[model samples]
Target: MISPTLIQAKGLRKGYGQRTVVDGLNLDIREGEVLAIIGPNGAGKSTTLDLLLGLRRPDAGTITYWTTDPSPHVGLQLQSTPFFAGFTAIENLRMFAAFYGKRLKDAQLMEHLHRCGLEEFAKTDALRLSGGQQKRLAIAMTLVHSPKLLFLDEPTAALDPRARRDIRELIRSLADKGTSIVFTSHDMEEVHKLASRLVLIRDGRIIASGSPEELLSQYGTASLEQLYIQLTDEPA
Candidate 1:
């Protein structure tokens, strides 16, 4: 059976004065799937994410959500998550829970912490946690309200191999339980492991998009990295 479309964006165009970041883009985010947007530094991946999450309004386009109240159903985890330095991991979760009007019991909060593999550091100060732990805490904060749609920008960026694997597993678990995710990452391996579908953007336009196998076959490339290079590499 075909999954329902959770979000539909048509002709999404955004720019800063003369430079267009996202240009005439069209995309559909389906229910209960991981869609990864991959691109180089200035490819407007972040801008596209911001626009989709309603953080920035598109200059020209229509974004439609299937749900009547989409705002409450969405969650966002940015590249640099902001946390109170003095707050413990649990405290941070509690504070964000309050922001979402959620009142989580200590046990419930601990369950989330354990799920993120941060149970041991539940009482640790947010600033003291390792990079991986901090990222997990950020994810816990985002999932506190149990949002149906998650927007993650670089969820596994700058982490060691084990940390990246853990985060990837956590994401896969969430998807297994029916959470729809749209994320951006430069790690082609991470993208290969997590993304059910992939979209490649360059200089504000979607250059290529498809499932990993589909794209590889279409481009006749050995891997996503080679395909990406082939698609985005400038001629000498």
Candidate 2:
């Protein structure tokens, strides 16, 4: 096994200036588990992700991965960014894959392209691909190394329905293989569909964290979306 849990963050805190984004947060993402973070606008979801990914230093607290070998372990699919816009999709993967110090053959790269349903676009320049395609390419890069701990930010934000389904399936398959995931999304349905555990963030704090069913029953709400508004907006 890849261990019981892959990531544990305690009292995690991060912020800019006076605005504390992620405040005294605590999280435990286990191996082979899909944990999703759902929250309303400006809830510091991205900030929390940044802290976990080591993209930024926490204002207070610590994040440690549970593993025998700890070598700055984590992969992040940025919330929104054009990856290798000037290069072809395959070419971009070729470039990013090198950083992992693992050699994924050309055939393997093609498989990821195919998985993204972008096999036809393999030769297409990333800049030429549509917004959704670009996002898929970024996600493909993150998986190239098969990193055990992954932090995905709004991965399917602009994807069409079919693309969304494919990405969700891909994530599930990875988790099945013992990969841990921390996904952030504004799409309530997507979070519920893929997240084994859900953590709701509001204004830089985790307002609630539990299983999807637990959240529904706890709030007596019909759906996660409804619960989201109730928790964050407090229902005027």
Worst 10 residues of 1 by lDDT: 227-236
Give candidate 1 regions above 4 Å deviation: 234-236
lDDT (CA) per prediction: 0.92, 0.84
Q: Write the per-residue lDDT of candidate 2 for residues 1-236, one digit (tens) a residue.
A: 54486778999988789888787998877877789988877888888887776678998998886765544366679977657667899999888888778677889999989987888999998888999998998898888877878889998898999999999999988888878888888889888889988988877778899889998999999999898888887841
Winning candidate number (TM-score) = 1
* Residue 89 lDDT in candidate 2: 93
Worst 10 residues of 2 by lDDT: 67-76
For model 1, state the Cα shift of residue 178 in Å. Answer: 1.1
Q: Give residue 72's lDDT in candidate 2 (0 to 100).
A: 35
Among the numbered candidates, top lDDT falls to 1
